[model samples]
Target: MPSTDFLWWRDGVIYQIYPRSFADSNGDGLGDLPGITARLDYLADLGIDAIWLSPIFPSPDVDFGYDVADYLAIDPRFGSLEDFDRFVAEAHRRGIRVILDLVLNHTSDQHPWFQESRKSRDNPYADWYLWRDPRPGGGPPNNWASVFGGKGWEYEPQRGQYYFHMFYKEQPDLNWRHPTVREALLDVFRFWLERGVDGFRLDVFNVYFKHPDFPDNPPRLGLRAFDRQQHIYDIDQPEMFPLLREIRQILDAYPERYAVGETFLSTPQKAARYCAPGLLHATFDFTFLHSPWRPERFLRAIQDWEQALGDDSWPTYVLNNHDNPRAATRYGRGEDDARLKVAATLLLTLRGTPFMYYGEEIGMRDIRVSRSEIKDPIGKRYWPFYKGRDGCRSPMQWDDSPHAGFTLGHPWLPVHPNYRHRNVEAQRRDAHSLLNYYRSLLRLRKENSALRRGLFQPLTFEPRRLLAYLRQDEHQTILVALNFSSRPVRLAMGRTLSAFRWRPLISTRDEPLMPRDGFLTLRGDEAVILEREA
Candidate 1:
């Protein structure tokens, strides 16, 4: 509702909720639909326009909901279909849209389709998954490797065939080339659309289709076996684009609907095409998530995205997700919210739509998981060296209580040890907490049109550590200056924006920060949003 003049996806913020870790109401220590429904008012107060829930479909929990077993049903661990309907209705009532994560690329090995497909080649679902025969001698069809650190091909002795998987062996890649397979997956979208899911975040959508020939991926210099190959044949195939168009057609039939994608190994150039007109509405740019904690790096990622967008496409940015470590830990000093406040300012004031991971508002840090405590298969396979994603997928910290107020029962993953002090309840009471900082930034963007749908204009001013930019429209012009360093910097207003009168809208510093003697002095690790007047 901030910018009623533009598309909601283009002008609004989306909050990512990993349902398993968000909240648990059933005392089962796993988050559920009803748990989310109970927290609608909090999300509404946080000022997000939509909530992109990670996969909640029925699953064997092999991949923690990503290996979907049933596209039309809810996982019993999460709740029932009726509970999901109530959650969506509650979100809609609070002016928050619901975007379900659709994993069209693969399914759990236990899925009925795979069960039948693996029994024999003549079954109705025999071709539902990508099943191939062994090589001439006694090896996999090609040299494709799984993303979770093993050979991508799993030999099924029952069917005497090997199925390809881009991720874990539990997740068998679907045969999107099969007309029936495509139709069945597309129908999954329609089912959820009819159920009032406002949009979908297509999981690993770029890998939906692989090369028909199943050729061996060319080798490259890299860290591990999976990264050693160029992955030219396994991902970003031409066939996926047409499927996106078909999905777009289905979404277009409904009003105010949306669809964004999560491209495996996402790139700006690919996003340019994936978000092209008549295709996806947008695709998550992980550049912001993986970029170094530097001012120039962030500026470069923002500028690159601007150049990559076509005439009809928009840019979406992400800094944290379930699979990545929390940005608060990546970019901030231990127990310091200064850098987080600065990052929040830039994330909220940028040209594109910003995505907030759950618990990011209170500056949640990653929960370190030891090898014995790891739940993620990725962590188990690559422990001590990589340590996997379980650190970031921990339960949300709500209060300083047993299990961080997530549940009375044990949590699926450990809550961050710092949750006792850094949590929503404690931060809610502190005026200067990171939670309040996010609320202020969201409120500022909502009240200012120049900050919401205006064009982004990067300022030439900088000491290399400070990245300043302007957001301008016919109505007003706003300046956002961020100091990435721990030392203050002074920027002179000698030309350009200096011609207009300015007012300070918000800043990370406790004291009022404004220009003095035609110069703006920024505190260490500080960011300020100022509105300029003619």
Candidate 2:
């Protein structure tokens, strides 16, 4: 079991804010630190314990803020360092923890270290980034492919060599093998810790150290060039273990600080290994994010995560993020909110920390981006087939005003067209709105210890259309049942649970049907959480 003592992150909900789209203060068309500071009360009132802000460091915005040009400074486009300081202060005043995204695996090509390293091979910072001479056949040194597209190695004419970049060409991979490089990155962590940051969300963390020999990845059958290879040599090297330990040590020095990593091309088992006494506090498991809305698939994903992580390790659940399409758009039927409600019920009532992407509570849908208005390089390169991530990265719809009250000026990306009727302001007054449902669920989770720290036991014997699980503790036991189908389901309580008297705590339907005999009948796309004294 996890520690009995209170750990804020383990029991809390983390609301991820894509800073560029959250709110635009000063009519700048882009969200900034000041804008975030102005909205701290809204987050606190929403009942989220922490806010995970995406990258706001100095960058050229090639891949948004992921391409960091300066690790120690804030980007002018977002705000100055003073603005970040104020944001932290205001968030803490409202009893909210703040975690920043640390893109340690790579740096922007425009970074000073990379600029000097590329000038000459013998410079002091020359070894800071991965550089290799062309092969005898005058081609890339290895067969590794960039995640964006094409070869991972970009030729640098000035240095007469190729630099490695697992992502976009503007972002170059760092050489973690070098002691100087490791120390420099650690210092970056220290800089933030000293500035009152609570934790870090490590980006592409598992790929920090590639194979030393830079061998070619074995080929496989797939659509993208990157997917055609097994990625054995390009990512998830053993060297990353020690680096995680070092990062954990730094975080431990600061009280109540935490770190969570993003694992690339990893399974539940791989993600579990990253969390322990000396590593990350948690790692995101994308099993549910990639799976279709099926009962068996979700059950298997949850079971796989529970079995792999054991009883001690904490797990994280996410249905939407900056990289993926909106969950409502992916799961919703035309004009029906039942599916989204069911999804939200599963996310909040599950036995782990739940991460909510901005606009998810309002049932936000992805806005289609025209080819001419596309900003993502991946969308531009793979147009007509892949429209890119701009759909989910649109500005948040706070109200029914022009641009959804996100900004006085034009938004960086278009607001969802449905925002006029489906926004936060309109939903605030509706008792049955998705936003209100989410708020109620969060409040319930916060008040119930069994829901927050209970042991999860899946009712595997249930029918394929029903997903049932029991979260129990010494104090209370809660039964969660979700119907994935569009037809009513009469679910058996199973032999193990039929003896107890179940009382309804919350349900997706406006009026939930109580348990009759040993079975509970649920409407299409409905869910319920029932409590029984332990």
Candidate 3:
């Protein structure tokens, strides 16, 4: 049983499964709904409270599932509606809540609403999407660029007008100003809620609203011209808050259901605003995910969040996800797999809900995306500069089998070059594989209540090359210490140990750090969890 209150996600851990990359049951080289259905036990054994499945709704595959063609139906490439029902049922039976990804800011151009909206300027659906007259000289409506690296507006030959698509051209932005569109989307929400879903992870949650006047956004100031623009006209619009409240009202109508918004823009103070009581229950804290591998940077970012967000609202912390490169490639020193496992220990022991992206447990590295293998539109346009998200979105490495056991057919995306060295089958057999470390860390997290909801405070250690902290409650306290450097370090506790009994609960070293007296001497790349003496 979960130690924390059964709030669905109060300091709960969530495993994010990108369905197409998880596993494939059929020989079709693509992961489908039934494929994910087969993986429930894998997730359940990980001891997570919820599973955040990426978009599985019907889409044109323009941006994969992000470009939804129908708000209420499952994509045929995945499986039938009945398959999803079974997935939900099986997950619930295993004590895992299923949270679907809701992409509401836009829809595919192939959607019926968009089809009708583009038919004529006088049609009832004409205002359902953002439409604008072409520039006087017959060009795009503005100089704004799509996130996928092209003009944000696409001109329609039939209507002689342009429509806004903040992302890909196939994904046109929906006009929230339309009462009918909002109501229709709410109906879709009700459709799933009635189907027994626990909640939603709103994708691009902050990007749902736009400037009402269709004004041209001014250029950005500090970063690149793209980063310089305040996005005043494109995103973080003021209207999004009220809509969030309305959405929260809808969600609150259901029992034990929660909503988590993905806001990657800023720190916790900014992220916490999305979690303000009546809106989202939690928002993604992406600061740690973006920071360099430094103990000070990590400590400051986590402390900054606690100070900014207050103690009442829950926080979500993640190391990697479908959008980012694997942490092993980003933070690991070559051949130093222990560093990666130590990172996992920190992630699971942190004071917020931990989100483990699929394949992260196996220490998956970013798949090399060659120019020819590139499929993501963003990567195609950005090329060498960005390389898009395909590298990180490759199929999971289940084994050394062809296609890493993801499929018998050619996968939608190619597997990584490191598949043989790092896969589930090899790791499961190897006692020291990163996968086992993750399982042990997860089990440790579940066994200790203090690790779940205790106050977080950094231990002022010899901050030269080590990171240490303590998780404590009224009856129990655990000290977590990690050596971040490649050299041995001596850390003295300084009379802080006199009144308490102490025992070493966990150590990443092949041998104990040293005799437990007033200090602990740790070797390179080692982490230990210590319990207070009773």
Strongest candidate by lDDT: 2
* Cand. 1 TM to true fold: 0.98
User: Global CA lDDT of candidate 1, please?
Assistant: 0.88
Give the residue spans of candidate 3 off by over 4 A.
Answer: 1-4, 135-143, 222-225, 514-517
- Poorest 10 consecutive residues by lDDT, candidate 1: 1-10
Cα lDDT, model 1, residue 269: 86
Q: How much is the lDDT of residue 178 in candidate 2?
A: 97
Alpha-carbon shift of residue 360 in model 2 (angstroms): 0.5
Better of 2 and 3 by lDDT: 2
**Local distance difference test values of all predictions, in order:** 0.88, 0.90, 0.82
- Candidate 2 residues lying further than 4 Å off, grouped into runs, are 1-4, 460-462
lDDT of 1 by residue, 1-534 (tens): 245575667788999999999989989999888888888889899889999999998888888899989999999888999999999888888888999999989999888889889999998999999999999887899999988887999999998999998888989999999999888989998999999999999888899889999999999998878999998999999998888899999999999899999878878887678989889998977887788988888888888888989457788878899988889879889899999999999899987788999999999999888789998887787777888888888899999999999998999888888989998999999999999999999989888888887898887433388888889887888888888899988767667556778888898887646777777889899898888865
**TM-scores of the models, in the order given:** 0.98, 0.97, 0.95
**Candidates sorted by lDDT, descending order?**
2, 1, 3
Error of 3 at 276 (Å): 1.1
